[model samples]
Target: MAPGEPAEPETAVVIATSGSTGAPKGVLLSARALTASAEATHARLGGPGQWLLATPAHYIGGLQVLVRSMLAGTTPVFLTGTGFRPDDFAAAAAQLTGGPRYTALVPTQLVRLLDDGGAGLAAARTFDAIVLGAAATTPALRERAAEAGVRIVPAYGMSETASGCVYDGVPLDGVHVDLADGRIRIAGAVLAHGYRLRPDLTADAFADGWFTTSDRGIRHDDGRIEVLGRADDMINTGGVKVSANAIERVLCAQPGVRDACVVGVADPEWGEAVVALVVPAGEPGDLRAAVRAELGPASTPKRIEFGAELPLRGPGKIDRAAVKTRLQPGSHG
Candidate 1:
């Protein structure tokens, strides 16, 4: 497709999702859907104003910032000159010329912002809402941000929805969120047409006006949804199925732990073994007892590896395949 040339009748833009591995899928988004998403965000956030584009534009989260800004009739300030850091963020934020400032970020970037003590936290508080997308955030991170007087709105969506169609576990106006066979499903004006060049994959994912997500979730009686980890990520050991997300929450809550990734490793006797790779804050302590006490011995990690940083792929998501390889027997990574 050349510049100024017409895209497919159904699609205005094709945003490729960042997969952990293998070929990335290009999501065919319609102009109507993208604009609807931006409009819905403004409705939920009171009103859109100036936006800060801290993330790369290629990602949906970043792309939505531009859309929201355009819809708001505001010029967005871009973060440049270096990687995501507190001073740079504050400096860029200071350049915003519109009212009710906003920005979108992955949880990892938010963590880095909070790490600078109060400078970044103070800068983040200036925004009317800070949309956290790309991955699920820990309760601890949210509490810390709240304590610092920063507003963090957790968003759930993907390229297929144009951006985040759910905010703080509640579906945005005109959007529908439900569970099908323990997996999350979404339907709304914000939904994309389908995946480009993959009719079979598109057909399998979207049906009956709902796009079935790979993630497992629980829909609250009040219409809120709680996203568990991916369905395939559940660890089964000795006939017991354990939620890796649950264990990760426990591990992250433990003292001296910063971030954690839990994976299932192939085992001879147990079929699969639970393992963890954790980033320690300072002097690490024994984490086994905490997991054992909270989730029982079956869910407890068979082996725990502490690292300085986690291997990440596709918008700050934990590289699980890499983590699994690092925890595999006799593998030194």
Candidate 2:
């Protein structure tokens, strides 16, 4: 079911997470929880600013935009069926002459706007705030957007917490953030009741009145939380658990690598070996030296594949399954 659609009073709906690691779990969000989440998000985002609908409405990001607009008493400008060019977005965003204009964009959309250049960057600079969600916002992207004078807030949350309960890695107003055993724990009005049809998962996930996130994180000394990566994505090679997202972060920092996805390949001895799928900006070879210099040998990918772009799901996150499929025969088996 598409996000923001009027769900049955207490009926179950399936919502897919990014599914970068394993299978996508069909999360059942009730209408009540959905309503509560939308209302809470609207309240936190300063009461339903004008929304530019870029991401697919089937995803939570798109669904929340519609719900937030409804709560704010405004209609979101649909970018779908209108084309996805930066100029198209600029024209639409420019035409928004209503209450505080805001838009939710994934990192790729934001980057595309910047790359489209000309009026595109200028257009993006004019939002009340441009929220970056679904994936980690690189320092480079953040710096560029900030330089362009955009209020670029890096958001944190997932399908469970109703999109994002944290902005700039900090918990939203009225939301409680805690770290237990390096996992992110959240509790507040914004939190969903529980996942439907998965009572065992609900019990295991929500503990002590707080929903425990799959992300491994730590509360900073300054009170902000940094999500390290998904607990399941960790690869234990020779008794060492290496974070795939952590490795991707380092690899993505190199020039010519527009994107990076690190995964663990089964090995007879080490149990798992790290392999990287890179979307090259220029030359794939240049990234190898950069990885060696920056991430060191252990973290350096045993194999690197350059391609047009990484396979992405609804929100432009790397599709790890597709990446694994690209490996040499018998590499993963």
Candidate 3:
């Protein structure tokens, strides 16, 4: 784990994909795949110079920050703090004195930074690139980041792909990313070998050297991947397929809708109807009307439930399954 240690060529590294779906899985990554992905990122971003590490070393994204720094022959600046905050991250970046400094963060952190405004937002704008991962980025956040003069790159990758192979809405170099049967499949040297000790799960997840992710995606003509939430998160209502993530994205775009989640509830008529559990901004009912107006009838939720806040894991990812359990028949509202 030291700099230039040359340990086993790193065929795979385990990263805990957030348990937003059900259970988190430790994804194995390869050295070649990781390197290829890094190279691709550098090629597009004008090569790696110096990096600022704000994430935990245990996470794949955090580990890749170290890898990139070592590969560039530079030591990265670390964020020595209790937990993630805009002030701490900005202070860490301010300490760096060399080339362009880059850091990775989850969407929740980005929201906090945007909300902080003054020094935090100013510091956030100073970075060469602010990479976002772990969960989907809201359209509102993306716009806010741009207006703040910060260059933002939204990433889509798991531990199996060696952290991330897509940057700024574009796929990394030499990585073959595609969608098969609604599942996101990645093929390349960066693909993981298999799961640690679950052969059955591994067999179901991997095929012919390509790692199949549980998340659904669509590769647009521009070669950008549009992730459509997890496959298991889909809700089938009266023969109509509704994507919780897709609807959530639209709902989150509405004003006063702080956080949004779409879930399937058993219904005698439709079998299952799409219901929304939202974290509203002081006015839940008004936000619900806005969401309805935005997505229209089909995508609109049959009912909107309010929560003070959405459940979160690690950094800023919503624990969808946990939220589902909270919304269970007898659970607290």
Top-lDDT candidate index: 1
Worst 10-residue lDDT window for candidate 1 reads 1-10
Q: Would you list the C-alpha lDDT of every candidate in the order shown?
A: 0.88, 0.75, 0.76
Over all chains combined, what TM-score does candidate 1 have?
Answer: 0.95
- Evaluated at residue 105, the lDDT of candidate 1 is 91
Better of 1 and 3 by TM-score: 1
Q: Arrange candidates by TM-score, highest first: which order?
A: 1, 3, 2
Instruction: Indicate which candidate wins on TM-score.
Output: 1
From the highest lDDT down, the ranking of the candidates is: 1, 3, 2
The C-alpha stretches of model 2 lying farther than 4 A from their native spots are 1-14, 30-47, 283-289, 292-295, 328-333
The clash count of every prediction, one per candidate, is 0, 1, 4
Of the two candidates 1 and 3, the one with more favorable lDDT, higher being better, is: 1
**TM-scores, in order shown?**
0.95, 0.87, 0.89
Error of 3 at 142 (Å): 0.7
Clashing pairs in 3: 11-30, 12-29, 13-29, 33-190
Cα lDDT for residue 238, model 3?
83
lDDT of 1 by residue, 1-333 (tens): 243655657787889888764467988898899999999999999887889999989888898999998888899999987778888898898898878999999888998888886567778988989999988889888888899788989999999988998899999999998888999999999998778767898899988789998889998888789998788878889999999999999999988888999988999999999999999988767798999999999999999999998988877777888888899989989
Winner on lDDT (1 vs 2)? 1
